[model samples]
Target: MARDIADDGVIDGLRAAATADFETARAMPPEVYTSDRFLALESEHIFSKEWYCVGRSSALPAPGDYLTCDLAGQPIMVIRDNDGNLRAQSNVCLHRMSTLLQGRGNAGRIVCPYHAWTYNLDGSLRGAPAMSRNSGFCKDSYRLPQVRCEEWLGWAFVSLNPDAQPVASRLGALEQMIAGYDMTRYSEAFFEEHVWDTNWKVLAENFMESYHLPVCHAGTIGGLSKLDEMICPPGHDAFNYHTILKDESLRIACAHPSNDRLSGDDRRMTYLIAIYPSLLITLTPGYFWYLSLLPKGPGQVHIRFGGGMSDDFKGDADAAENFRQLKALLDDVNIEDRGCTEKVFRGLSSPLAQAGHLSHLERPNYDFARYLLDRIETGQGAV
Candidate 1:
């Protein structure tokens, strides 16, 4: 039998750490990452109730374009309807409970592979083969269950909970803070999915803080980092962020000449934003990238990684080459992060593993732990 999360003393440790000041705060207990019971609690109270980022709206620009994902064990799809509106609906067919769509592509209508049951782009039941003899059948009575989906700054978010708060309202401050970037104009260059052998939170924390950059990323962007220039401010209820000014040598990371909105230090600044539960974004003046995380279980994470160039740089003579180099550099950074996070998970499983004091740079990690605890303990719906 699995150990109960509440009785294993992990909650007590997290509670204490969550409430501590930065000077005294410690890393979360190891069991929080290694316990099946705790993962179950997170699945129920956190993942199921929060707004999860699906990706940029541009990825499904045309009618009939759609993408599928499993949110907290519920299979859902975000599709562009015939009217060019994005809609979230249960991907399961109503008749035999079979998945109606796989992976992602353009579809005039949802057609079930198990049977010939079909649905319109709006999710209305269009037809059911050989059902005319069934006296009780009513095609008008059935429709795919709708899920809450909203667009904020061109990114699409979906939630299973009907009563979940609107994402834009909670993130108004964030939008204002990044208004100059005009994130909606940044086009996605690539999007890929991968699974790593590590707890989701571990990778999230790694992204939240850059304290390990000098050592772990020495072969890549580490040399360009100026530790003293990095800023870690108090996070809000909805998100946490830190900014770092890029070195001049990495010209594409700095604002393009055409961008008049940013001046002085802002030209080279990069913001690492963590929108609670699981979206991490690195917004730079010339480009942007993000990771949308989902836990596979106690020991593995599913990652939706995508990024693109800012519109300001699109007219530059060297724009294509600059983006190519930037993507290659980012790939190298991910390789280092994968190795580090997987090692952390392995260490967490040892009997001698223990939490350690956090650095000032890790303030975001501390704030994230508190967010998790608040939701897991009180069942708070959304940020």
Candidate 2:
């Protein structure tokens, strides 16, 4: 019942099909979803080299506020320092490699619960208890390893690789694409995380297209979207997106009433994108939500899903009520996606499983397939 992802041929076959037209493009080979070897390679070449969005900067709005997380299995922490700047660093205690913190909280000094080692918000060592006894111990010389961190439009991102470039360089176009929204002013309305029983790509491909809106999402958010209106444009080197129009009939599902000032498609359309590696975003005039995926294994993924409200909506008197309603809708959509992706994970192992033709609606998935193949074959995207 195990998959053979060890052979290079599994990836070679995918590279061979990378140039096909979107309509003629085939799904990536099944093993790509269930192979441990391939997942390891992806961690090394893609995740480690990319700047991953951990959460919105507003989540840690004050000095000493911090959130602990893992990116590509690299344990790290994101914190707002005394100077009001955000910092990311290895969350492992240097004394004994024990984890330094868990979940989120505000602390003036990060104290390792395991051994009582203390570190400043900037990652410099403050106290080592008995560590001075070591022959070469220099408390001043020991500090937690710092990871690269940056923020754009109110979201904070961290990278395990020292050479990773700023996310803005690769995402400037996407930033401008939704410029009217002024994402920075938005504040997180809701946040959630789930460990799904599906491959990371399975969930990624799910978000990159609305082809499933009419089927998988049914009766909910999908009710307002039609595959015909989904514009799956060519993907950029860093991401892919498609625009979907909301059916005018559903009052609540339509753009927020307060967003009347937005013009044209901004009033009627929603755009969703999958930033290379694992960030998935759904942007609308009034609000936006994102899912940051981390592959846990061949059959599991860690998903962080949350949404924020535009300045207009955030200041709306009924913002609380509206956020409550929005969370309910997204939760239903998550249930639907979970069911579908988990089942697909099971199917990737079916003897009948084979690459299939891509639907025009599945263009993002096709582009994602190529994006993955390009990296796996040549490691062309690290910086």
Candidate maximizing lDDT: 1
- When summed lDDT is taken over every stretch of 10 residues in candidate 2, the lowest stretch is 249-258
Q: lDDT values of the candidates?
A: 0.91, 0.83
Q: Write the per-residue lDDT of candidate 2 for residues 194-295, one digit (tens) a residue.
A: 899889999999899788888898768777887777899989889999998877664433466666556776686788978888888887766689999898
Worst lDDT window (10 residues) for model 1?
1-10
Candidate 1, residue 286: Cα displacement in angstroms equals: 0.7
lDDT of 1 by residue, 272-382 (tens): 999988999999998899999999998899999999899887888888998899899999999999999999999988877889999999999999999888987887333
Which runs of model 2 end up more than 4 angstroms from their true locations?
249-261, 380-383
Looking at candidate 1, what is the lDDT of residue 236?
Answer: 88
TM-score of each: 0.97, 0.95
* Model 1 stretches with alpha carbons more than 4 Å out: 1-8, 380-383
lDDT of 1: 0.91
